[model samples]
Target: MRRLGVWIRAKITLSVLFSLMVFFIFLVTVVITGVLFFLAHFFGLINDEIAKGGIVLPIIILISCILIGTTISGFASRRMVKSIREFIEATKQLAAGDFSTRLYLKSPPEYRILSENFNRMAEELGGIEILRTDFVNNFSHEFKTPIVSIKGFAEILKHDDLSREERDEYLDIVIEESARLASLASNVLELSKIETQTILTDKQMVNVGEQIRQCVLLLAAKIEKKHLDLELNLYDYSLSGSKELLNQVWLNLLDNAIKFTPEHGTITIEMKRPAGLLEMVFRNTGSGIDPEAVPRIFDKFYQADTSHSAAGNGLGLTIVQQIVSLHGGTIVCESEPDQSEPDQATAFIITLPSETSK
Candidate 1:
């Protein structure tokens, strides 16, 4: 609450101080001029002709007051607008893609607050610019890698002397790369669409637990192949959101869990309503994410522990976060490199409001 009023208080304080200073300056000038006149009269220094007819002293005193006031006002105005000019130039630099620009205002509490806010904004913009550049560079590399692989393998397959098994393996490689490229393109388009959606549409009262189980069934083949021990600690929790979108969230999370989980590892899906908000946790004994990388795991094209996670295009979590946001929920990755225990390993926790309609 105090923060809410800080800017208002600052503006009022500044205006009142400026008004008081101006009044005090003129009052001082008048007081000094009156004292001079009184001294002259007491000393009999002003002749009767000068006092009654000339009016020279009074005019000169008035002119002196104007000059003093004008000089002080002009100097103060220039000082004040110096900050404004700095602000304008900073803004120009910011618009020119210089997210490093900052402001440092000392006087006028409002501009100080503005300076702080501007620095914070610049910092955030700088981080975003870095992310954007990384995304483009990563996108180009990811896009080109599969194409090069496909072309090279196709050329290998074109050799007539190749054995049947060799030709079939090359063809499989080509098909896999094509599928990967298709998935990447589809995810990019989906993320673009989801990012532009301000409000959730096609909402229905979805059975959250049932939806998760269905997603598990979709990836049952992968789980079986990995020999993963799957656990379900879910309850009947309904949610009001797009069922299809939420399905994507679980499928991607489970796919990642399966992709990284070693043979005979555990995968657990638990949904619980504690404090009235449903907390759906998907945990797997997969590769642990570095603590520093956890915060940026959702960023587009950010893959943590790339050595263990090279196969992914890194858009899954980004899409999951966007869809979760559309549903007015939050999703987080709570995995640390130190937490390598099977049950206490990497986990994705999604929290959402339970449906009142249920």
Candidate 2:
């Protein structure tokens, strides 16, 4: 059907051009034939009947050709112009966010290709639009949750009937909710900067082992509270990157391990030079990520568990991945259900290129 439309459109355009050419030829033929006939009559080169026939024949031929040409031209021009107008209109509709609009044009192969390209573009636009809408909706809901909790808690604290302990408890709840909101906002802004390539990294040579140690220290309280065993196998390995961003990577990973790992579970950190690359691995006994969620683990605002009980805005892994990419490094995760232990075992392996390894 589409092919037929394209052919019809092409035919129409050709017909219009042919019609114009015929009109031009008709006019020229009539003028030249008239001049020749007049010259012959005036010079008496031919008899009156012959001259008259000559004049009449040329006029008759010119008139017949003009009529035929005009008819053909009109038919071709109409189809061609109509097809072009339809195509333009369809394009406008698409530009106006109507992805369903399609150009049913009968044109040549070139025009058919154009239509196909347009359709493909529209399909991509539609998909992006859907993603944008979903992102916006999800963002709004995420933002609203903390704000509502903070507001409710603040209002409760305002009541005079509440005792000192009750007021303090309410204020604590408000403070916690406020912190959650702040964290969410920060993550959103950071992700935007990363996506836009606006965030600059201050790269420098630093000890990767020390960075892991710092991260473990930061989460030392939580690890102790959980009674988790901490193990470190550090070698003299270093990496060149923004220390602050790299710290965030370690902090988020270690934090996640502490959060998910059960009591008495073990968390291990290892740094070594392997195959001319600096490799850092953080492993923990925790609930292994579901196979379905593994692919989306690094996606911004994506939580494997939708309940939001986890202590994160779901942007931690995303930030880690982005930082690693900025440093021209790679990170991977391996996990298995630890049936022998009380929890699953998961390991995150990070490899920095030898050129950047110090």
Candidate 3:
């Protein structure tokens, strides 16, 4: 449970031992010299000249040993103290919201490990800090949109000169804007709960085909409105996960496809067995994700393009990824701009363990 560096501990131990050894050696030498001096005086072998010369030798040896021991102990203690102080300061900076701070102590292996762990901690903190900042900015903008729309429509409704039809239209706009705001808030809350592990799922073996059909039915209106083609190649695949959560996952993915795909564009859902795993591939002929943004596509509040800001608050993919991970699965994206074939198109491939059905 003691997480301090090994080198510092070793250094302290060695310093103490060295000091004790010097003391022991000095003590033994004094005892032997005292016995010899006493015997010499009693035997009349310590005359004035002999006594003077012998006294100076013992004094010189004792002084030299004391000076050497003190100097070595002081140097060793100073080095250990400096390393510990640096480590403490680095941790304090990290606690104070400075995630970039790191301990540069390179004295011993233990210090090295401590520094490495500190760096890892700092990196994690920095990542979370960035995510929090982005979430706040995105949340504000998402809320602002609906509020602006509602305010504009409400002001129009306040006009006594407006016709009945205009007033009804304004009211409808207000309602729609309110619904948008509610939806944004709901999604944000769900994402937070999922990320914080507050939302538990009752996972069970589920038919992927049925789930896809249900999601498709939910988005039937959007698909028809956009005039997009739906192609299904499901193979009665079953996945072990929360049915409700997985249903949401499919809905978000397909919904995103419908939202981005142009009229006459095609959205395909394919399930296949590959390498003892159940794989679901959702490909859409929508605007391809930017290569630069592909790495962070699943990151919360990340959008490929700012123009699509009106479409979503960008937490949909983040939620989808979390749900998949909860099911012990992985999701990957393959996309290229304006590609001809389905494989070349923007595709999301999700792989789940096939054993979930058992």
Candidate 4:
């Protein structure tokens, strides 16, 4: 389909040139032949003309017309080919990671449109390249930090003179850093796996509200540790999709809510079906997300808390977003600073189509 669309748009110029060249040659042949016949009859020398060359004039005129028409067509064809060649070469450069290449084509609406689209694609590729480079740098730093901490703490533990309390603390720190490293590795692998999936598999009719409740219960310990108040208004709801994937969505969101909410903070989970949309919202009270960070919160390796003080590798929300996308859903986050709103605060809302839509 895409190839056909391209051909339909690009073959107009060549088709017009070919048709015009054929018409020009035919017209010249007819007019030249008729004029020669008339001149021979007017001079009453038809027999003399026949003896002299027998249609030689019309044959010469026909040949000249064809040559002229061909030459003109060739020039037009060369310009068209040159422009196409430029597009091909630019595409090759782009494929080679040269996102800076841009087209500056002129004339012919089709070629102009092609150039504009290609340039826009190049610009997007350039932006993605930048994001990829930044992700790699951030990933390396994140991966190195935990490993270094573990190594440093282990080295300290090697001293026999250290008291029991000091040794336990050092060992705890090593254990915590090791866990962080493992979590980071797991999130990376999970994100890679989910992103490569084009369609959701292992789908089943899952009680989504029950799933959210289970996620909240699973994190009950952490919620209790923080002395946070939890509210669940989960009306019974079910969705037809990959159960394991949806489980990750709820788990990640609830875990994030637990991680970021302050002690004695409030966390609320709500599920409802409104206008054929299965909407779930997780709201938590905290310092609130930076307005600037809200837009990029789902981006991989982009953390609102850039200080790394939070125990996240920034892939949780990314994974959540991807899973929701695979399920043909949308997730959005809105935040307000402390005291900017009533008791309710920063919220992440996810909406999925009803099972019938699926």
Q: What is the C-alpha lDDT profile of model 1 across 53-120, one tens digit per residue?
A: 66786786778678767766676667667888999999999999999899998657777888999999
Cα lDDT tens digits, model 3, 156-227, are 788899999999888988998898888888988998778787444586788988889888888899899878
lDDT of each: 0.84, 0.77, 0.80, 0.85
Model 1 ranges with Cα > 4 A deviation: 1-12, 28-68, 308-310, 336-341, 355-358
Q: Stretches of candidate 4 above 4 Å error? A: 1-14, 21-51, 54-67, 356-358
RMSD, model 2, all Cα superposed?
A: 7.0
User: In candidate 4, how many Å is residue 102 off?
Assistant: 2.2
lDDT of 2 by residue, 163-212 (tens): 98998888888888888889988988877776677445667787777888
Ranking of predictions according to lDDT: 4, 1, 3, 2
In Å, residue 340's CA in model 3 sits off its true spot by 3.8
Clash count in backbone of candidate 4: 0
Better of 2 and 4 by TM-score: 4
Give lDDT: candidate 2, residue 147.
90
**Candidate 3: 10-residue stretch with minimal lDDT:** 6-15
Q: What TM-score would you give candidate 4 relative to the actual structure? A: 0.84
Predicted structure with the largest TM-score when compared to the true one: 4
Each prediction's number of clashing residue pairs: 0, 7, 0, 0
